[model samples]
Target: MTTVYIADTGVFVRCGGPDKSKFQRLRRALQQAGVSLRIPQRVYQELGGNPAADKYPSGDIPYADGFEDGWIVVAEELDYANPLVSTVMDEVRRFIANETDRDEDIIEKADTALVGLAAQVLDTGEADHVVLLTTDKPAGRAAEALLPQHGFSDSIEFRYVSVAYLESLTADEFW
Candidate 1:
């Protein structure tokens, strides 16, 4: 079964700066495993869109190397026309709002795009399994909790991309 790996902005951030060894470690692991991480379009935007993000030390990501080497890709735009994609995104918004005890209006499509893309990939049979690499607790939990209910039980996994997680990463993680 093919497994699609989806990554979020935090994964790169947790890898530290452009010159950090952690960034190289992650790149090496993925390249060795022959696996590429697919980022939701929103995540791709978040990684480099904010001018302010450049002020932080961790924001100077060397992800361009991953792209140039062909191990980090920006996924296709989320297809709202796909019922499963639209439904899951809407549900994720509500799920995250409830989890944070905030009003539903406070949640945005960008916040749930990870889960939406996962749902779309799964529903369309693009992947037999989906692994989410994210530091967004709410979205990760929502994907784990909701995807199973949609008949994806055991087919979805969320790996919290912590500093330690990246520090000790190996090809085994992707396998």
Candidate 2:
């Protein structure tokens, strides 16, 4: 089955420094798997949009190199017109708000886009399973807890890509 691996910012930051071993590990893993990490537009923007982030050693080089190497990619535009996409996004918005105990209005579409794209991929038969690679506990739980209820049982997997998760990561991560 084709599995889509969705990555979040923390994964990149966890790599640390330009020559961090974690970076090589992740890159090698994806290369071996012949699968690239999919970043939500929000994540892409978050990685490259912050000047403060640039100060960090890992952030200094940015994630664009991964993009160039085909180890990372931006998910395609979410078809907002698709009812399933729109519906799931709304559900994610509500789910995140509830999970984070924040106001619904404060949750932006981009925040919901991760789950929405995952749903779109599943609903469209683009992927049989989704592996969410994120450090965001609330968001990961939201996907795992809610996606199955929507009939994607056992199809959505959330892999908490914590510092420890990647700290030991190597080209064999997916192996």
Candidate 3:
């Protein structure tokens, strides 16, 4: 089955900066696997939105290179009109809120957008399975728990993009 990798802002941030060894590691792995990561539109915005992020090396995202090289792509806008996508997004909002122990309104669209994109791809036949790479434990758990309820059992996975995870990344991981 075809699988799509959906990555979040934290994953990139965890890649560190200045040295870019982790970033290069991830890029090389994906290149060897002949696969690419699809980031939600909100994730792209989050990556570039915070000017404050520039102060830290981890925040110095070289995502422009990822985009230019075609390995990191911004996923299509969420189709809120699609019932499945909308429902999944709504559920994700609630799940994240609960997981984070915050009010539903405190949850941002970016969090839900990850799951929404996954649902959209599955509903549209864009991908048969989805692998979510993120450092946000709550959002990651939400996707892992909820997607199966929508009849995508065993088709959704959440891989916590920890420092060790990136350090050990290989093309074999994609397969």
Candidate 4:
């Protein structure tokens, strides 16, 4: 079964600066595993949209290198036109709001894009298994909880991308 690895902004942030060993280690591990990290468009925006993020050391991502090397890719735009995608996104929004005890309006598509993308990928049969690498616990939990009920049980995994997790990462994690 093919495993599609979906990455989020926090994964790159947790890698720290471009020169950090963790970043190199992550790059090496992915390359050795012969797999690329696919980021939802929202994650791509989050990585580049915040000027304040530049001030943090962890924000200095050499993502360009990953792109140029072909181990990182901006996934195709989420097909909201697909009913399955839209429905799953709506479900994720509701799930997150209820989980956080917030008004449904407070949760937006951007907040649930990760789960939406995962659902899209699954429903479209693009991946046999989907692994989400994210630090957003709520969104991660939402994906883990909802996708299974859609008949994806045991096919979805969420790995919280903590600094320590990245630091100790190996190609084995991808396999």
Could you estimate the TM-score for every candidate? Answer: 0.89, 0.85, 0.90, 0.87
Q: What is the lDDT of candidate 3?
A: 0.86
Model 2: lDDT to the true structure = 0.78
Leading candidate by TM-score: 3
| Clashing residue pairs for model 4 | none
User: In candidate 3, what are the lDDT values of residues 118-152, reduced to their tens digit?
Assistant: 98888888889999999988888999899999998
| Candidate-wise lDDT, in order | 0.83, 0.78, 0.86, 0.81
Model 2 worst lDDT run, 10 consecutive residues: 49-58
What digit string (tens of lDDT, one per residue) describes model 4 on residues 136-175? 7888898899989888898889999888888899999987
lDDT of 1: 0.83
Roughly what TM-score does model 2 have, to 2 decimal places?
Answer: 0.85
Question: What value does the lDDT take at residue 112 in candidate 1?
Answer: 88
What stretches of model 1 exceed 4 Å from their correct place? 49-62
Model 4, residue 137: displacement in angstroms?
1.2
In the range 10-42, model 2's lDDT, one tens digit per residue, is: 778778844888788788778887888887767
Indicate the TM-score of model 4. 0.87
Model 4 residue runs over 4 Å out of place are: 49-62
Tell me the tens digit of each residue's lDDT in model 1 across 20-138. Answer: 98888888889899999998877767776433343221344456677667788777778999888888888999999999998998886666899998998898899989999988889
